[model samples]
Target: MSFLEKPRVLFYLLLFLIFGVYLSTVSRTVSFGDAGDLITAAFEMGVPHPPGYPLHTILGKLFTALIPIGEIAFRVNLVSSFFGLLTILLIYGIIYKLTKSPLAAFLGGSFLAFSTRNYFLLFCFVYGLALTNHLTIVFLAPAFLFLIIVTIRPSLKRSDLQREAEPKLQAEAKEGRTFPGSLKTFFQELFRIIPPKIIGLGLILFFVGLLPYLYLIPAASHNPLVNWDNPKTWYNAQELSGLKRILTRADYGTGRWTSTTASVIPSGRPAVYQLLFFSEMTFYQFAGLGVVLLLLGIIVLAKKRNWIDLTFLLSVFLIPSAGFMIYTNLSYTDSAALSALERFLIMPYLGAAIFIGWGIKSAADFLKEKLPQFDYRYFAILIFFPIIFHYANVDQSKNYLFYDYGRLMFDSTREVVIKKDDKAVAQPTKA
Candidate 1:
């Protein structure tokens, strides 16, 4: 077998290649948006804005201390790069596991890594980790649940059937003279189906995951430089209101919905226009080819009667894209609002990438059967189509516009203060 046939080898190859890409393109210093504030919060171990991303802040602090690289801002940016790489690897692993094809996984993972949007696609991963954008990550819950159910369904069914048979066996034993081992056999099957050890380990890990949130309490208590909504303050004698405020995003009025409950398009627009706006955004994702592949993938799954996989993929896509669109109720003409909405598309775009992989595999299989001598792996070159189109748009290497602008403002302010001090000294203390 060729080296590429080994999934482990291919996984490492992807890791190195994508890491290089990320390192080249990652922001050197603070970029726009919450990056400046986030870097300060990470440096000071303080809480950021609403829904204080305790986990992100904690991880960022570790990166900032440990990296010893360029500026502290760059180290914090590396946290985003690291999580983005992990997200890409997860996509690769999921696709490869489902398709059993390295080519498909490569295509799926690369499509997502290189897809162009307002910000890099991985901004969702970064924002989801460090900022208030939780819905992008939250949308994956349904897909994860579906996967868990599908994995254990067969064993669960067998367990249920065995339990039903136990009553009949007991009834038969009551009628008969003997059947001594039925109870022992039933208890053994119960343990086999749902092992206590596994359940205990799962519960332990779940709680461990929640441990990151505890960082908020102590960090907030210090009341560091960039603390937003000091979560250490008490609401009553018993409860910490500031902590509750940060967690619930009470200051932002998070739970309140607007009157305009329509599709992803602006509420005032016609349905046709709204759909056209939505469709245009979708079309540009992978260009026309990606849409075709997405449709083909759906068709392939439907034809194979793979309802579980189909539902999982569709839920991952729709819940983040359509669900968020409705939840946000954003305007098409509002550039800032639309840009914010665009970052949420990463999760859905990931789902589309997987579908594109399936489509690629299906097409490659058809071509191989017709021309037995042809190397279908060459079709992997199609991954570059996205890279070529999106490279110019997403490339951030040497793009220090935000960083330079910030520095220039800081320097100008310092110069002005220095000149004023010099002028005062020149006046001889007003004598």
Candidate 2:
């Protein structure tokens, strides 16, 4: 059978292509902002800014050390590229689970994988690793929860038992015991369906993933040349690595929702303005028709009552975009600030891409049934439209915008310093 018939083969092929593209376009050197600090810290085995991101520091350092062919920054950037590819692979698995059709999953995965937005966001993990990132990934929690639950649900029992049991459970829920009692019972049932092995494996993997964070204590002690916040002592390291600093981002500025830092947009503009700004950014990224397809996909998923998939998509999108709008104090007037905040919307945009795939598939199937003469493959032509457009915008081959910008900034600073020195020399000595 063709690879398409056996989805795993198709997934690997697509993953190879994704990795190749990112590898070719990976940054050659540190660009700006936190990147300089990240690469330096990783290379020197030093602690980074607040939250320390020991995990990222460890991986980046490993990549830098092992990859002898490139600049330190380039090697570190490869870490993001690696995780980015893995995220795309996970997305493909997610879509395949939601829709058994390999073609649909392939299209969904490829659309997001090739898109310009993911090129920067690098899945939600990149956000966590890219210390300068955002809380957008928080929104994906519910989605992941739903995905895990659904995946395990089928393996728990036969289809007949599940269908019959759900109704009885729903009736009990409707009769309503004390809220806490009901909640406890709900979880008890959920736990029963999930295998103990699955639970143990998940816990083990999570903690193992977190082992990288332990690298912070040693890195902090080494007193690296470029250490930020100077987490040298046990007490200071504890404070910086504490929940308060990591969650509230106390290292940079106020961690509160109201705190207006470089990342936060001003609180002056109305909510509608921010909505428009976000909509405009998304439109340009996904294109107009792509947006429509996403909405249609939501409707299609909803009508079919694919609650697990539907809820996951909604949580991923709404929690970041809609919920963030209410809490974030971003201003509508500061175009630069608004534009900067647009990156946080990447997670929601990812949900839109998945929906777009579903919508296209739904439409193709409907048309095929209604109009027997038309080939379903022709409908796939629509999928290529977004890919073509996104590739055109994100084609990074030989792109040196960041390099040029960094050079200009460095030159400007040097000139300013020189001018200051010249003035100091020229001035008459004071009494």
In model 2, the clashing pairs are 265-330, 265-331, 266-330, 266-331
- Tens digits of per-residue lDDT for model 2, 251-279: 55654433344354444565766677667
Supply the global lDDT for candidate 2: 0.65
Query: How many residue pairs clash in each candidate at the backbone level?
Result: 0, 4
What is the TM-score (0 to 1) of candidate 2?
Answer: 0.74
Name the regions of candidate 1 deviating beyond 4 angstroms: 117-125, 128-203, 234-241, 256-275, 415-431
The 10 consecutive residues of candidate 2 with the worst lDDT sum are 419-428
Assess candidate 1 and give its lDDT.
0.72
The candidate that wins on lDDT is: 1
- Poorest 10 consecutive residues of model 1 by lDDT? 422-431
